[model samples]
Target chain A: MIPVIEVKDVVTHYGSRKILNHVNVDIQPGEIMVVMGGSGSGKSTLLRHLIGLERVSAGSIRLLDQDIGHMSHHELTRFYRKLGVAFQGGALFSSMTVGENIMLPLREHTNLDEKTMAIMVRMKLEVVNLAGFEHLMPSELSGGMLKRAAFARAVIMDPALLFCDEPSAGLDPVVSSSLDELILQLRDALNMTIVVVTHELDSAFRIADRITVLDKGEVLTIGSVDQVRASTHTRIQDLLNRRFEETILDPDEYLARLTGESI
Target chain B: MEHSVHVQPNGHIVSFSGEIDLENSPAARTRLLEVVEYATTVFVDLTAVTYMDSSGIASLVEAYQRAKKTNVAFVLISTSPAVLRVLQMARLDKVFTIHETLEHAQHAKH
Candidate 1:
């Protein structure tokens, strides 16, 4: 099968600093790809590039076999309509009820009337296991409920590609595992390609068919869950074992920085 | 419709068996409504229920509403995992009165 997403020689720089260096990944159709790394590992930057929010300095990103760089503005909009994104913080409009929040995308993109829209919203809520909770405000829900609500909104359109950022963050173990189960269900039920960005090791292993480990602005390894877990690489080992690696200081660079400081 | 109702000293104990789903929820709703109409209080025993889908949940909601409107006390007794999951997902575990055991629900104040 043709890969749903292909990234080749992706180079991204933030002002004078290089953030992503020749990153490459090929995500298969209906696959769950978990991009994981510690802080400042450029995983988030790669996500931004995938979503077309950040411009890559050099590379080609072919989503659904269409090169993102070659697409027109209208083409880009149409391309994005087939994709869904769930942000880390839920990003719900506190003003709207849960039903309205899930219905926002449909209202913006479709011309369905109120009744049809309501039925669709209910169906999506049921998929997320939040049925009969549409009228409640965001503040009325617990943290886990908020995340599920956000997921309901993201899948409202039934996008072929879904990107979830830190889905397990701030959730307890049971709730997190349930959310992971929901992600797998979405993939099976909708034939969706899901890319999850999470630092939670258990959650990643539970959902990911393949995982891409990013470290210091490069792709460390892209492999199956077993391969990534069993690798003997020091950085990957440190990350998997949750061991803190002592930062080795460069004596010459340290002396130069210390001497150059204004005193 | 595969259920039995016993008029206890405090309230009526209604026991439901088999699968309480889309097909039987209508009959369940009809029987449940009848019990809640005359009784001062009703206790739903779902321990023997093999399954309950969303429609079953709706039927219980209807019973709750009927009890609320007619001033009849409504309570759920002895929940099974299959039934409890749907209830909790709908957040009705907080909405409805629940008891750990059928005896507690049966003898407790309505």
Candidate 2:
């Protein structure tokens, strides 16, 4: 299988706190790889690093034959134009219409005329089941529509890589399920590679071609859905069962944090 | 939700009270676009607005686009944390000139 993204010995940190320790991943072309972890598991940080948003202290990240980790700011900016990101918060420009927001990438990266831009924007929206609503603002959309709009904007440029951060977060179960279906359809219809960072177990199970489970900045396992489900790793089982281990805290550190002396 | 649009000497002041949301945003967008066509300046006063969602944000964005197209100065006056947080998430704080009060927004020469 051809790899679209490769993370090799990727080490990252937040100040002195190690976020990702020697983590590696290979996402195949046209595959939907879901990265799942509990809060503070560094899934989000990894997404940031993968997308060239955050600089990593160590390791090499190659996306589509180019080393994103070592790319210059100028080069990164140009490279980023070929990518699409849908943040958890929808990240749509509140000042632009849905049509305008969806067309933003096309306008920025391509010299398509106004008519062509409008046509492409409408087409993408239609794919997301948001047709005839382009005049509506992001605010007018329901949570489901908002997510769909984000997806539309993300795919407007026909990017080779699409990164979605918590696409189903804060949405209702039915809406979220529909979003999962849309994600699958998007993969099939557009033939784009997607990297989704999420904690929603149901969403992960529904859309992922493969699941990459992370725990405390480390990869617990990366395998097919059935393999992940049948894995005997205590951490993986705990994550799947929603069970949290008792964190034995040291008295000194506990007292320090309680009294604000830790800082 | 109650929305009103007025033309001040310095610019246009569009005010909203109660919820600026899905039910009211269409009307609000209509009102703002009306003023944005001829007014060289626009200031949306959202001080009394208790709640705002995506629809409300879209209204403001439409007004901003109108302002830009017609070369009108557009600013948003918001002191409510709820409203401000949403703007921050959408990163519209960088796009719209935001102030704490209508007075500051009106006097903002920049």
Name the candidate that leads on lDDT: 1
What is every candidate's C-alpha DockQ against the true complex, given to 2 decimals?
A: 0.04, 0.02
lDDT tens string, model 2, B1-110? 89788876888788889976544666777788888888888888899988775456766776787689778898888998777765664456788888998888766695
- Expressed as tens digits, the lDDT of each residue in B1-110 for candidate 1 is 38999987788899898887534666787788899989998999888887775456666777888899989999997568767765665467888998978888766776
TM-score of 1: 0.65
Worst 10 residues of 1 chain B by lDDT: B82-91
Candidate 1, residues A87-162, lDDT tens digits: the string is: 8889999999999998988677655445446655776788798989999999999888999999989887767789
The sequence of per-residue lDDT tens digits that candidate 2 reaches over residues A139-181 is 9987779889998888776677999999988775678888888
In angstroms, give how far residue A95 of model 2 lies from its true place: 1.4
Query: Number of backbone collisions per candidate, in order?
Result: 0, 4
Clashes of 2: 4
